[model samples]
Target: HVHGHFFALLSGYIDKFQLSEEWHRFTGDSSITDVRKCYGEPRAALHEVCKYACKFSDLDDPKLWEFHQGVNGGRMFDPAGNLRGVLTGELDQDSLEGLSGPYRDWVATWLWLEKKYHLQAGPPPTMLPYV
Candidate 1:
C-alpha cells in the first residue's frame, strides 16, 4: 500500500516536471525502490527530521562556515519539488496574512515585557548596547 501510494505520487511529480526520462535513467531498475510503513506520530517524526537537517552544534566549527558560504544565496528549504510552491509563497497567502496580525501582536507584547522587566531569555538588554 505504501509503495503504491509513493509510486503514484512520484509518477505525478515526474509527469508534472516532465522528467520521465531523467527519473528512469536515475532509477535504472524501477522495482528496486520501495516504501515501508513506519509507526509514530507524524508531527514528531517531522520535527526529528527538521532538527537533524538544521543541527549546528558548535558555532566556531569551520565546516559550518564552509557550508554557510556554499549555500549562501540558495534556498535551504525546498528549491523545487512538492514543497516548491509552499516555500515560495504561491500557496496559503490568505491564511498567513490572517496569522500575521496575531503573531505580530504576541511578539510585540513579549518584547515589551522583556524590555520592561529584565526577563533573561538571554543576556539582559543593557548588556547588549547595540540592541
Candidate 2:
C-alpha cells in the first residue's frame, strides 16, 4: 500500500502549484510512492519531494553536529537495491567492474578536488562542477 501521509503532503503541493495534469502524466500507473520520474527533466516535483530533506543550512552548528552524529556511520540510502551485495564489495571484480564508469569518474574527480583543496566532501562540498 502507498504511504498515505506522504502522498497527502505531495498532493497538497501539487494542488497548490496547479500541477494536476503534469502530476497525472508523471505518475501514470505507478504507485504514489514511486519517484523515479522526478529524477528526469521538469524537476519541480523533485524539488517538492526533497525540500524538507535538504534543509540543513538553517540549523545552527551544534544542532547540525548533533544531526550528523545521529546519522553518522549509517547507510542513509540504498541506491543499489537488489544489487546491494555487489555494491557492498561482497561480489567479485567482474560484477563491480560493470558499475564503474560514471561512478569511478565522479569519485576520481571528487578525490582530486578534495586533495587539491585540502577539504572533505562535507554536506556542501567546497568544489562544485559546472554543468
TM-score per candidate: 0.26, 0.28
lDDT by residue for model 1 (41-130), tens = 643433333344345533345776887798899875543444356544543244421111111000111222232212122222222121
What C-alpha lDDT do the candidate models reach, one value each?
A: 0.34, 0.36
lDDT of 2 by residue, 104-129 (tens): 11111112222221222223323333
Candidate 1's error at 21, in angstroms? 14
Which prediction has the highest lDDT against the true structure? 2
Cand. 2 Cα-lDDT: 0.36
User: Candidate 2 at residue 44, lDDT?
Assistant: 46
Model 1 lDDT on a 0 to 1 scale: 0.34
What TM-score, to 2 decimals, does candidate 1 have? 0.26
